[model samples]
Target: MNSLFLAFIGVGMMAAGFALYSRFLGSKVYRLSAKYATPAHTMEDGVDFVPTNKYVLWGHHFTSVAGAAPIIGPAVAVIWGWVPAFLWVTLGTVFFAGMHDLGVLWASLRHRGQSIGTLSGRYIGARGRNLFLVIIFLLLLMVNTAFATVISKLLVSTPTAVIPTWGAIVVALLIGQAIYRFKWNLPAVSVVGVVSLYTLMVVGDRFPIVLPETVMGIPDRGVWIILLFTYAFAASLLPVWVLLQPRDYINGLQLFVGLIILYGSVLITHPDVVAPTFNDNVPEGTPGIFPLLFVTIACGAVSGFHGVVASGTSSKQLDKETDARFVGYFGAVGEGLLSLGTIIATTAGFKTLANWEEVYNEWSAGGVNAFISGGGSIINEGLGIPTSLSATILATMAILFAATTMDSGVRLQRMVVEEIGQIMGLKISALVATIIAVGVAFALTFSSGADGSGGMLIWPLFGTTNQLMAGLSMAIIAVILTHLRRPAWPVLIPLCFVVTVAMWAALLQLGTLWAGRNWLLLGIDVVIIIAAIWVVVESASAIMRARKAPAVAWSDADTDAPAPHHVG
Candidate 1:
């Protein structure tokens, strides 16, 4: 079948899900109301609590959550075949991730913009809140370490991407000044910012920048990872409007443009799907597709990480309660679209089945490399762009995606650590808290699994932990709904599904790690399982208590009510 046909089918399915299913979720399930005053307005503080435009907030939310996981997960999970990956990205985004994100955002909005980690105290009790904070801190730490390694490896392998990646940061800084300082029009600035970044890509392709292995007698990748964490530390310390928001806005626009080019190229080229829809000839030790595929494609389909981003940062900036549906649900749909593009690009971009098989024969060789080559081939054939330039552009995209995630992850980690400190009555400065967070991430990057392969040793835990986090967030939302006398099925159903799949996947991984005697990963896996159980038990208890207590006539839609106790 022609690649464009598959693209249309996938895109059409996602659009329909957004229109029909998501609309139903918003109106019937979530019942988003414009009447409620958001934290951004109620707690307007000119810093983290400033109210933001819906469109800009959507861009920030989407790009922050988009990260490298969506691309990496789908690209890797396509090993089973495109059909499974496509279905999951389509249905999972609509039913699972969309609801998860929207519900958490609403939960946070109703609770004074406190992150899910902190909100656990109100809904799940003090102990639940403490455990949730620990889980969130570890999850964000893993995110930082993993993405730092990912960005460094990409830069090392694709030297041409180095210049453009850094160039985009410089552009973002300028764009930030233009928008915030000079009050420049956002659309014009965004267009110029994106165009300038793409121009840098062309320049980079012609003059690739290669960094030396050692600045002063150190491994290059290690140095790069340290430099990245350093940047994250600084970026996290800056206010949201200064660097984080503007940078993510520019990157978000770049992603949209890249997707259009990719999908348009598919239409022009009409390439064939050389790979099969379902490949029964499996690798020897590959886990079955049932639970493994679900967890493997976490972000593309329905990542728990999205829930954290929703409740952690995005909820604080929302201008009104009703925008949660748009920012949360549509953000998920946007990720689903990206995943669909990955499926199409990987399955059909190659000229022959043998070439595709060779690239995908091993998981290590596939991932971002395969997607870049294959997607670049399609763009080259369709748009007459040189394959080298196309590959450079794609590589830059992957690097930026990872870098954006790292920036946001570091910031979230700092907030989590500080929250924990406050709960424990330890007075920690923002600088000290940020350093501690970055230090932990830096240490993890060099742990025993650091086999010079860019933290691949700890990657297995990322997906499961991410899904478990989503399950935990959804559990919190479910209990909150029950307390408010709202329908809890929308959130509860997805929570159960995520917890089941994640537990299964984690157990499977634990067995392998135990046999291999990889104590670090094995220990991490056990903690994840325990965390899942703790959250579920807490949620169940909260639900039972809510049932026995009198309904407090609490409506999230009430805009005139006094705000809850402010934490940060």
Candidate 2:
């Protein structure tokens, strides 16, 4: 059978399994007896709270969960083969990610939209809450860095891709400015934003503006990193509707078209899939099917990062608590499906192209100009699309994917700064706090990995790290539910399993880097190991605290922590 159809069967099965796991038996996972439940706190206006519609909440939650991590992680994991990747994406979402996401959303809603970190304090323990926040901040910086790199790499291509990319950036900025500052109509401004981005692609085909791979003898990769950070700085400063959301909407269209083309190629070629499900040669291979895969595909699975979505922007805007269910749970399911589609493309559709090795090399070229040179053959053969257009389409998809996370990372960072500052009793001006946040964001973009830096290596690691955050959150939720004396089995079993796997994955990565003596990778490994240990340690401690603390029922709008760092 053709791989596309095979993919469909596999994905369909995986999805079916997820439903069975989530619905009939999930409450047992959450240990969800009403007695074990969190109180559904009421909302209020101002910084403390605001209500929003589930539709919008779903949109925000989905976009927040959709980031470079899911895309890159699955891509890397699938190198082992689509089967294992599919299995992890499917099973993990059904059992691990779905439960984690629902638990976080439900818990946050119970506590007046308090973030996971803060909720850790109220429900888990004060020290546990601070600890969780530290892990979160580190995870955030890594995420921002990875996505920025991903965008930079995607844009460093033919003049066609580069020009449209830069144009989109400028256009996104202008649209954002118009909407937020000038009070321009949202609908009209979004239209102009789309036109402007598309126009760059169209006009560039004629004028053909390109950013060459290198300038002043700098490696093209370095140039992309620098430019990426510079742009992230500005993008972070702007309002969501303008640059982030509008750009994502336009980019989402590109992702949609690219996926379609990829699926179409698979349908036409019907290539037999040869990729293995797992690679034994890399033994000591990315720790087996537990935390490793779960962590590697965090966004595609369940990400604690979404807790920020549940509590931050989405919660602030939520019109009702019931909306949290679909918005928080199902929207994540949608992104999981999207990533599954890409996995299908990579396994089934990709083989049709004659020279994947060559395409891989091209995609891995020295700078922006490198891919342009290698584009012709792959487009003609494997992808079976015209080079100029396919190149634009592919490049646009990467940019858009990266853009989604950029917004998420930026917003999370802001909340972190705000949250930590409040916890520390530091009264910093909002402007100065923003500057610190921006600077931290930029630093992440500049960091690198062995084969490549930016998004490629870092993002998968980011996924692993992100998954750890999810695992930690799930563990906290399970522990809290248990301590409160409620139905906690469903959440605990998978939550423990996922986190255990994730820890092994992190350990393996740390071992790999330590053995190789690769400085950048070594640094990443060192930091992740530290963070994971701290989170695990704190989580264990939190459960102990929960077991010990008298039932301290939560009240709405309670401001909090003893120095924010140790909260979660």
Would you estimate the TM-scores of all the predictions?
0.95, 0.76
Report the C-alpha lDDT of model 1 over 1-568, residue by residue, as the tens digit.
Answer: 6788878887887778778877787777667778778888888776677787777788788888988888888888888887888889888987888888888888788778888987777777788888888778878877888888888888888888888988887998898789878999988998899999999999999998777767776577877787788889999888787888888888888988899989989989889988878978655666689888888888868887887788778988998787888888888888888888888888898989888888888653458877898889999998999999999988998899889888888888888888989998998888999999988888778874332343566777888888888988888877766665678888888888889998898898888999999998898788778877887898887788877766645566554322222211
Clashes within 3 Å, all models in order: 1, 32
By lDDT, the best candidate is 1
TM-score of 1: 0.95
State the local distance difference test value for candidate 2. 0.59
Residue 209's lDDT in candidate 1:
76
Those runs of model 1 whose alpha carbons end farther than 4 Å from true positions after fitting are 448-454, 555-568
Error of 2 at 560 (Å): 12
Evaluate model 2: give its TM-score.
0.76
Give the range of the ten consecutive residues with the poorest summed lDDT in model 2.
Answer: 363-372
Worst 10 residues of 1 by lDDT: 559-568
